[model samples]
Target chain A: MGDEVSSNQQEPEMSQLKPDPIGRTALAVEITNRLRQMILEGVMQPGEKINEKALTTQFGVSRTPLREALKVLAAEGLLELIPHRGAVITRQSEAEIAEVFHVLAALEGLAGELTAQVASDAELAQITAMTEELRQSYAQTDRPRYFRINQAIHQEILAASGNDTLVKSHELLAHRVQRARYQANLTPQRWRAAVEEHEAIAKALAARDAETTSRLMRDHLLQKLTSIRVKS
Target chain B: MGDEVSSNQQEPEMSQLKPDPIGRTALAVEITNRLRQMILEGVMQPGEKINEKALTTQFGVSRTPLREALKVLAAEGLLELIPHRGAVITRQSEAEIAEVFHVLAALEGLAGELTAQVASDAELAQITAMTEELRQSYAQTDRPRYFRINQAIHQEILAASGNDTLVKSHELLAHRVQRARYQANLTPQRWRAAVEEHEAIAKALAARDAETTSRLMRDHLLQKLTSIRVKS
Candidate 1:
């Protein structure tokens, strides 16, 4: 929660969010967004404690806005606040992870169904390209890059769904497990299976087979959970 | 934003959460939860601006924690923060409302599927009883009571899903549209259709007809949006 607090969040726009000048809510929102990014990126480990003084000092802010950021994260289920004490990034139990995966599967399944029914040809082509890119990443064994591309493909489908709330809700639950996914090394067999699954999903989506696309998308996410559990 | 802010938020549990006694994070969480409840309960109207000073004075706190609550609400899509100014409760557009209903339908669709597959006899009976109660409220033309029972039946299904994340995610999206539902006076025709839909949903659940339950649940929510739009 100090210098290690992911300066990737410290974009030029973020630096301009000085407190009091623009107002507290703006800065608080900025901090909340950045913290959410850090947690999702796995730069901040699950169950890692935040030293309030260090984080405030690191962000060049006071305790108030930092506390505000923590509150927002807690509501998002990305952080846990201990009563009368500081907070920690949340760690999901195996059962909790399974529950979240089930919900995400439903979200992605709906996204696929909607995308098949309405996505433009360009959107379908972009998803196909990402699926191909995901295959390329498979040979390299770079887990983070592969995971990022995989997420980009699902995100593309969600965007095509034309429902912002669907995307937001999916990401909120996805963030809870993305860190685990970033760290969980996949077995070679499972990696091949996931890649194959993506190929089938892309084909179904391109064919505009809404029901098949929906079922494939749902199965894809559930399989991801299976892979994580297998590897762990 | 003062007395009109809803004293119902000031439960005995809430009064115990003073800023200094239990710590900043705890107080912030309390304020965020209560604010969320107010928004959902329709005590806080959409498009209503939060008077930070008046709310702080009323809640007997400083601006720091109250501002913290605002940040959290903004993230949940229940509030919008204006740059340099404070925030206001979010008002959904017709388009936005449609988008949210689609997602909530997907969520409740999954909930119905899971509940059909796994919910115990007791849980199913309880849900059926709520459905009967909903019918009773319909006869009385008590909109709130009917709406509350309608939500309870849905909540019972979500609870029976055994997926806490599913329940949490559904509520987050449901909150976005619930204020509108509470105020949208339904036509008798639409009301009768909704009641019929619930009866069918309960029958599907009782018979363990997963596909029908899932389809019925999704259609039920979308039809609710249709009802609201019809009345408006």
Candidate 2:
């Protein structure tokens, strides 16, 4: 896993990569985002020890800032810092995975409830558009595209809630279990069910039914957990 | 706030303070915990710039590890690192406070549901005893003591949930709002209502009624938010 991540980074030098569009973001933030993406995308698999030397070489940075980024990710529960071994990608046990999904369901439910109350017509329309895109991905059986659009729709709901703390907390937890979620590709029946669930959630949001929207969102995420075959 | 925190630190010289028990924890973890305690206890006032010099002196550490700890706390939302300004204790707007409480309520609700399902008899007994102690503190009008006991009860509930991810997430959100929560002293009527609510939650947990327990626990925390007058 570490070697794959290292090889994938054989590209133009770090100086050649475009500077952050927002010049305000610090090096640590940029590095943290890159590492988090790699982990979530399974380029750095769960339970794999992070090769600090390789990462430093790949990013063309010293170990100091890279270590700082690892600390930040560790605090976010995406990495675990061992006493002597340094950092490793976090691996959730089956029970932990289930527990995370349960918590995510509640958080998403809160997002749906708040969004219904506060989302503007423009925001709702944006969500509707994302839903349409997700439907097309689903129809095309494009799993990766489906996943990306699905996340965007959920993220939009969180943003529409207008709760920065909620959004931040939700994003942290979402990132922790994202690899598992990415792997839990639905069976065809489950895929159909999920689409139906999304339809109901979108309808509730459109109608501004906070209670129904929250309930549907919560139930929808909870049902997603059932598709994961936790190893005994 | 700076003076108060400094005064609280007058007990011992940095060299005299005991070393970490395990001697294995990274300096960042130790520093993060100490700084987090200062912030959550309101010794370090919200938005106060963390005096890097003083903290480095107090902890007998170099700037490198201290800066790393600040980054970890920043990720945990207990501190914010501004561009060039360095790190300051986080300050949440009133809306952010309310949003945090709402998320806390949901997490606590899920805790109650899981605890009801799996908590050992001894764990439930521990919670009941904590409730009883909380009642005594309320009767004595010991607001600080009451607050401590109240937090302990909630912490115990989260612990009983047996979900590390849930507990970690809850603690992060709880610390972010700890100052506001500490300041939200209940009126006499609200105090009685809170005690009654805790009694109901305890009863439901004892009965192993997951649904009722979760609902009551969530409502109990949400009710606490009402006592807080958010600055408009």
Candidate 3:
């Protein structure tokens, strides 16, 4: 493995690299997405130093582009580039985690309020359907499926807000907060409460009750923050 | 002037450039600060292609660091890097501006609520002092001074919130939305109403009324949005 890594570290010409699969997307952007997914999914655990040699070999790219991708991720607050230590996935402190959740609650609440005002019937129907799906996942005790559905529902509402700036801002912080959230094992009572909160949120959306929807969304996120076991 | 411009354009080696006066700050970061100030002050107009060569000459730096600074600013949403066309200062559309203001209102509201809960006496006193200064500026019709003081008061509240993430997020959007705000000329009645709103906000802060303070802050921002004449 060491020999293979060393051989791959020999710099390859830029033209020899495979073309980006997504046309019009820059190579750095494509690399950034792949790295972001790895970090977000915990495949690359927080505080782990990114192995540039392995990553370059895995992606069949040169160091220049890979380093550039790291710079972009660092700028987005997903990674930290220490001068001599290279890049490490950032582990948010408990205080930082709480800070992120507080801001997210405000953003998601605003999204819910705006969606109520501007979402089309079709969009509202889609959110309602997702909520029902999430309910079924809960019933079946499929934690993974429930988590996916819950995220999708929140994302859909943000999209429905029809504000590009809000969506962008929310996604940036949400990406950082998700690692803590995924690790937080919700108790049975808290899980049930969350599901019921979703139900109320969907109902408010259906009724186009902007005030109630926003309030419910904000409170739901704040409640989730309490479930997180913050390390002292 | 042309001769002077040419003289400054004479290429200097990277090593020949002056060391950054801000100790330990990277060249790219210094460049980013200078560029951001230029764009914010309208020294570089919206949609104007960044003249890379001229900027390098002006900054007494090389193209590599200048381009890197442009990339950082682009990431901050203050500039747009068009493929092959070089970078241009971003011009927000009416919808985008409105969207940004809406999110800012939510973030600022959160700041007010949190600040009310946690602000130290000194912090509260500082805010109260800034409010008084702002009131005096309004009475004297010092629009520029009033704008500066208004921003300082808001900054104080965000600082008092004691949430780094909230302050970072609010400042990002606030920086982008400020150009539209500076151009908004408040009518006499609207100006007086704004001062009255600030008075109410100060009173709430003094009373430590979180709900009232949050609502007043949110409403104040939304009202300012109305004063902006969004171009069709």
Best by TM-score: 2
Q: Where is the poorest 10-residue window by lDDT in model 1 chain B?
A: B1-10
- CAPRI level of candidate 3: incorrect
Q: Please, what are the lDDT tens digits per residue for candidate 2 over residues B107-180?
A: 99999999999999999999988889888998999988988888888889899998877898898888888888
Name the candidate that leads on DockQ. 1
In order of appearance, the predictions have TM-scores of 0.84, 0.87, 0.86
What DockQ does candidate 2 have relative to the true complex?
0.27
Which of the two candidates, 1 or 3, achieves a greater DockQ against the reference? 1
DockQ of every candidate structure: 0.32, 0.27, 0.20
Q: What is candidate 1's DockQ?
A: 0.32
- Mark the 10 consecutive residues where model 3 chain B has the least summed lDDT: B1-10
**Candidate 1 error regions (>4 Å):** A1-26, A41-44, A139-145, B1-26, B37-45, B140-142
lDDT of 1 by residue, A169-208 (tens): 8888887887777766688888899999999999998999
Show pairs that collide, candidate 3.
none
All candidates: CA RMSD in angstroms?
9.8, 11.8, 12.6
The deviation in Å at residue B211 for candidate 2 is 1.7
